[model samples]
Target: MPETAGPAEGTTAPAFTMPASGGRTVSSTDLAGKPYLLYFYPKADTPGCTKQACGIQEALPALGKTGLTVIGISPDPMKPIEKFAAKYNLTFPLASDEDHKVAEAYGVWVEKSMYGKTYMGMERSSFLVGADGKVAKVWRKVKPEAHAAQVLEAAKGL
Candidate 1:
């Protein structure tokens, strides 16, 4: 299980590297010195997760104008992520955190209960990292709909 708490705003974003779709890997170092969004979701291709990802994908053009790159993270393995990206035509990175190390570092990996069954899973969360590598904002228990627009607005201030 992940530690009980996530990084607070103004703290330096935790660093991590994970395999991603498109035969590539994404690392925190890749986003350093730039404003970026790191979002965590439970699974790939599922309804809510897909909506969340597609929402961000839809906002990419607007978000790009602000120079804020976005990357989605999940504990699902590579194949599923590849499928998800291809299915949705996602232009941003979707990383696979099979070991959940990155999610653990971000404190988005946690115990969750669904329909009375408890298990560890990735929480629906997002972090906006400023150019200085400090976290500018954190969103926990995010709703899929309208989240991209909210994050886009928040990024405008960064």
Candidate 2:
């Protein structure tokens, strides 16, 4: 992870192009003219990450009703992400940031401490980007279990 700052609310989201599941390229610019969710997670196939992904998966209908598309980002490579999505039947796109470049740009990759040791990793977070391509809301240090419902509520208000 590199030292970078997060995009503030009402500011344009940092543009990125990353490999999505199934070897497709997905870019922030591709989402122009539509509201979308960009969620950053530490890793795939982990307990918390899986729970959060599934939660968002379950809430997709409501989010779709609100006219928002959800996309998940992580530092893991695409192969693992593909497996994770398959295992959980995820319908949303998951982008791989193997170098953590996009994660750093979003400010989700940062120094984290666990078990008294400090290291750089993706900090679980999410951003709601408006149809105009600016951030509408940010959820930092998110708790996985309730994240989807929380995001849904925020999207409804958007």
Candidate 3:
């Protein structure tokens, strides 16, 4: 797969709506006029993804204090997302992008090579959308363990 360019800072974020855990349909419109974070991970319940999700959950209070709403998106269906959220006691929304449309729009869907086998997967990434709905920051190929703190620090600057 060719590398696709993502939205740059000051560019409008791509719009999307996906089925979230708790039977909610989360849409970019729902976050209208509010700054938010949209993160994409490869899969639900996997080790690295789990660590990433939990880190965001742990960082929620501080992030919330900054008035940023965080949402995690993955190609996994709603069932797995629900399980992942419940298992980790996550308070934020975990949206399902089973068809990968949202991930593609965000440029987080990409081809991957692991152990010499190539496949399509969601790249671990986060986008900070400002209150005006433009990109504020972009984190590509994120490290799962320390990502949330980094995002919070950036959000504070926003």
lDDT (C-alpha, whole model) for all candidates? 0.91, 0.91, 0.91
Overall local distance difference test of candidate 3: 0.91
**TM-score of each model, paired residue for residue:** 0.96, 0.94, 0.96
Clashing pairs in 3: none
Tens-digit lDDT track for model 2 on 54-154? 99999999899999989999999888999999999998999999899998788888999999999989999999999999999999889999999999998
lDDT of 1 by residue, 76-156 (tens): 989999999999999899999999988888888898999999999999999999999999999999999979999999999
Better model by lDDT: candidate 1 vs candidate 2? 1
Q: Which of 1 and 2 is the better model by TM-score?
A: 1
lDDT per residue for candidate 3 within 9-109, as digits (tens), equals: 78999999888988888899989999999999999999999999999999999999999999999999888899989988988999999999888888888
Instruction: Indicate the residue-level lDDT of 68 in model 2.
Output: 96
Q: Tell how far residue 69 is off in model 1, in angstroms.
A: 1.0
Arranged by TM-score with the best first, the candidates are 3, 1, 2
Q: Backbone collision count in every prediction?
A: 0, 0, 0
Ordering by lDDT: 1, 3, 2
Per-residue error (Å), model 2, residue 146: 1.0
